[model samples]
Target: MSYLKFDKDLMINLEYSLYRNILRTNRKGAYQNTSISGCNTSKYQGLLVMPVPFLDDDNHLILSSIDETVIQHGAQFNLGIHKYNDDNYSPKGHKYIREYNIDSVPKTIYRVGGVILSKEIMFSSKENRLMIRYKLMDAHSPTTMRFKPCMAFRNISQLTRQNDQVDRSYREVENGISTSMYYGYPEFFMQFNKRVDFMYQPYWNQGVEYIQDMQNGDTFKEDLYVPGYFEMPIAKGEEVIFSAGDILVNTSALTDEFNAELKKRTPRSSFYNCLKNSAHQFYYIPKTDEMYLLAGYPWFKVRARDQFVSLPGCTLSVGRPDDFTKIMDSAIPHIQDFLNDKPRKNIIKQIDDPDVLLWVTWALQQYWKENKPVFKEKYVDFLFSIIDFILSNKHPNLTVDPENGLVSTYGRDVAVSWMNAVQNGKPVTPRSGYLVEFNALWHNALKFAEEVAAATNKEVLATTYEEKALKAQQSFIETFLNDAGYLYDYVDGTYADRNVRPNMIFAVSMDYSPLDRRQKKLVIDFVTKELLTPVGIRSLSPKGYNYRPRYAGTSEEKEYAYFNGCAFPWLIGAYIEAYLKVFSMSGLSLADRVMIELEDQMQNDCIGTLSEFYDSSPPFYAHGGYSFAMSVSETLRAKRLIRSFG
Candidate 1:
């Protein structure tokens, strides 16, 4: 039996299948994303999407979608669905879907008149390629499969229209044709494993709309270029593979290559396996084989803070320490460039986020705990340099307080920390000056650096970090602890914003904290009552200011509500850590209860992955990135922690 499958009753219902989408990544920044019923519902949906680094850092949708038609007795049935204006779907091909399953990769079975067809989708891990294998399961007569590809050679974040700039020509490749709609992009190829016929009919299919983007007040209509169709015959029980990618392929090897890549996939049989599969998708290497972890799917790029925060769980917790070394091997240099005031490098644009260096410190701490030999060999000196740079007040945005030893940043003008949602050129939640998590991370980094230095026999450095850590501990208690028992979210001069945000939970969750055991317990209790939800940790409590619980409104309104009330699944790991630290064996029941509730979310919104943010109130509608890197990473880490308790 499959772990996640929707039957014909569910698949034929457009209401059910349209809201749920599936994403498949090539592990190299390219992806194939669309709804489960083979309909493109968002601007980000595509079959062959790749990053053209020469043009920009964003991904371009080379192939928006492929429309397949099953033909028998010269009668054609289009097994494809596309949304247009006024909630109308042309051809309404979803009615033919028999079942949809992702037990391995995505396999959708469609039944036409007397014809049962199955299509399996897979991605090439090392290359920018997507493959779809179609098998005529049970056919009453000779069947011909027709493929009509919709091309959108534009950035996935933007919409394309009927324009004259498109190159409306094609050249024959191995068993298919190669064409590019725009200049400065690679020639996208469509090939088949067997002999096929290509018909040349170029036209723009306009007014194709995306429902999600439309509701979000974004430009949802696009015109896709259709370069004719392909015709191929198949016998009953015969399988053929269709390959699409930026790179040209040998047509004869399509079937074998698809099977070979399919063998590399880790089956989504269990919760851990599904998360493990999702974790592998965030590894994006766009240029020069330089590895980086993309923050999330469809939209987010490689970010310094997210790279570090998500690296340990996505790679280390999933037991891929070598990938951890590989990605950090490329990232450490870029991070150093930012710290040294050098020009920006190729990827990882957000190195200047206020807490990026602090996150790197924590990430290395995780590495050291996992594998000391590699950590020392690759990152020990680098760690020492990062701590030394921060201690010396060299970072552009961060400075260490000489009196208190806590880290501080100026964020009244521009938001500097991870709560970086902005509206109208101003920060929605400008958490500046002695941020709670920033200081928590500072204290933890000092303690961790002291341990590393002392173990490495650096007595002077160890003593320096230890003394500063002590000063920071005392000042943290005096400055952030409020009359309500929980720590203030941030403090600026005489102003202390005691918003019951999740930032305070990190102080209790970290390995080294200034708060004593009693204070930590108090924090956990307060947070559990005020902020904790089944989905994850609420960014701010309902009793706090700007308390908008629903993640609905105009685009700007949504941005304003962001970081004010949206509950983030990425906080599950830290929340669990704080809970387990305070309650230990006794906390397992409630802790596991929260986690199990989140586990069911794997089947919601997106299959095998968690969304970026969920509504804080009941029904917890997922609202942000469909497949968030931190969400999968932290969930994997929490699951591993749960096993350790047993």
Candidate 2:
């Protein structure tokens, strides 16, 4: 039985199906994302989006979509759906959908009049290839399935327009055709099993509107170049396969190749196990044996902050400590190189965030604690290197206040935190200075470094770090605690941001917190009353002046609301950590109870995956990127924490 299923009632409901999405990815950094009913609702929605290293590092949508039409008795029934101008969906193929189910993969059943067909989609685990298999479950007679290939050879960040430069011609390959819409782009091939006839009917599909893109203030409408259709005869009980990839392959082996990848995965049972699978999908191995974690799906790149923050949960909690260690080893060199550079004029001046280095320190601490004596001495040396780099204050935005020994970030153009949402190239929430979580992380990372140094008999280095940490802790206590007892969200030399935010929770959640027991309680109480929600923890407390209750509307509006008040499920991980730290078992139980909603949520947006964020108000609509890597990773981490507490 499938773990996640949507019947005709939900599939045919345009509103529901349009909101629901499906994602399939290969570790090679290729992915397929779209609405559950096979409609392209977002610019990121595509059948084939992969990194074209020759052109650029960014993912490009090579094959925007491939629509199917079953020709029976000269009557054409399109099995694809699309949103054109004015929100009009042509062919409205969702109406024919009988059921949509997801177990190990996505399977959709379509019933058109007297004919019954089922489609299954999967990706190659070792290659950037996607395969779709269709079986004629029950048919009255012989029918022909025509697949209309839509090509939009453009970066996923941009939209395509009707232009004269499009290479409309396609070269015939084995059982398919290879085509490139423009020069300097990878040639995408669409192949099918059995004999097929390709009709060169090249034209422009204009006015294709993506509602999500429109809302995000991006180009909503685009024109795709259709290279024509491949018509293949089908018989009852026959299975037809289609493959989309960089190069054409033997069509006969696609099914076997796909099945082999499927069986290679460890079997999953519960929702958390399903999430582990989703976490695994975020791993990108660009080279022979070097793997890194992609931040999120559809748009995010491999970021150091995301890779570290999500590593413990994505790997360690899933009983793959070796993977976690390898990822850490891979990321250390990058961090070291960034820190070796001279100071930046501002935090925003450096694209590789300083917070990423802090998170790396924290991630190493966690992994080391769990698997003591398992890591090599070189890993410990790497930790010391990070410490020396931090102490040097080589990052322009980061400097230690000698009087207090506390780290401060001076920047105007960036928030310097995860709440980074820029609209007009400026932070929505300009968080400069000594952010509460920043200091908390700083203290924790230093404490960790001191321990590693001391344990390795480097007393001088250890003593230096511990003394600095002590002064920072005292300064944090004296400077951050407001009259309300909650830690100040951000404190500059002149001003302190009194906004009650989830950032303060990190202070208590960290392995070492400067806050006393009473202070920790106060911060937790304020957040629980104002920021905690069933969906996730709110970025800003509702009582705050900057609060945005819901995240929706135009691109500007969404950007403004990005951190002001959107609820981020990923934060629940830290909140749960703080809860356990302050309240012990009761805190963990409360977190487990709150997380109950996530099980049902998995059936929504991205099946078997968690969304990046949600609206802060009622209904709490899931927003931002779907199948976000950190969200899935952190959710799995929280689950493991809860289990351990029990």
TM-score of each candidate structure, all chains considered together: 0.98, 0.95
Model 1 clash pairs are none
lDDT of 1 by residue, 1-646 (tens): 8888889998888877888889899767888888898888789888888889778878899998899998888898998888887888987788988889998799999889889999999888878888899999999888888999999889888889998888998999888999988889888889999889999999999899998888778888989999899998899999999988888998888888888888888998888899999999998776565778999988888878888889988998899998888898888888888778899775787788879999999988988998887777778899989998998899888999998899999998898887889888889998789999999999999999999988888999999999999999999999999888999999998899978899998899899989999999989988899888888889999998698888887877789888988899889889888888888889889878987899888777888899999999988989878999999999888877777888
lDDT, candidate 2, 1-646, per-residue tens: 6678899999998888888888889888899988898888888889888888888878999888889999998999998888887778997999999999887778899999889999988877777778898999998977989999887988988988999998887799988989888898877788887778999988998888887677666778999999888998899998998988987798878767767867876444568768888999888787766778888888877876777888898898888888987777666556665766644322112336757778888888888888768644558877877777778877667777889878888656875788888868888788888888889999998888888888778899999999999999999998899888888888887799988889999899888888888998998898889998878889888888878978777768888888988888888888888888889887866887878977778888877788889988888888877888788887888888888888
Q: Please name the candidate that would achieve the greatest lDDT relative to the true structure.
A: 1
Best by TM-score: 1
RMSD of each: 1.3, 2.5
- State the TM-score for model 1: 0.98
**Which residue window of length 10 is worst by lDDT in model 2?**
342-351
- Candidate 2 lDDT: 0.83
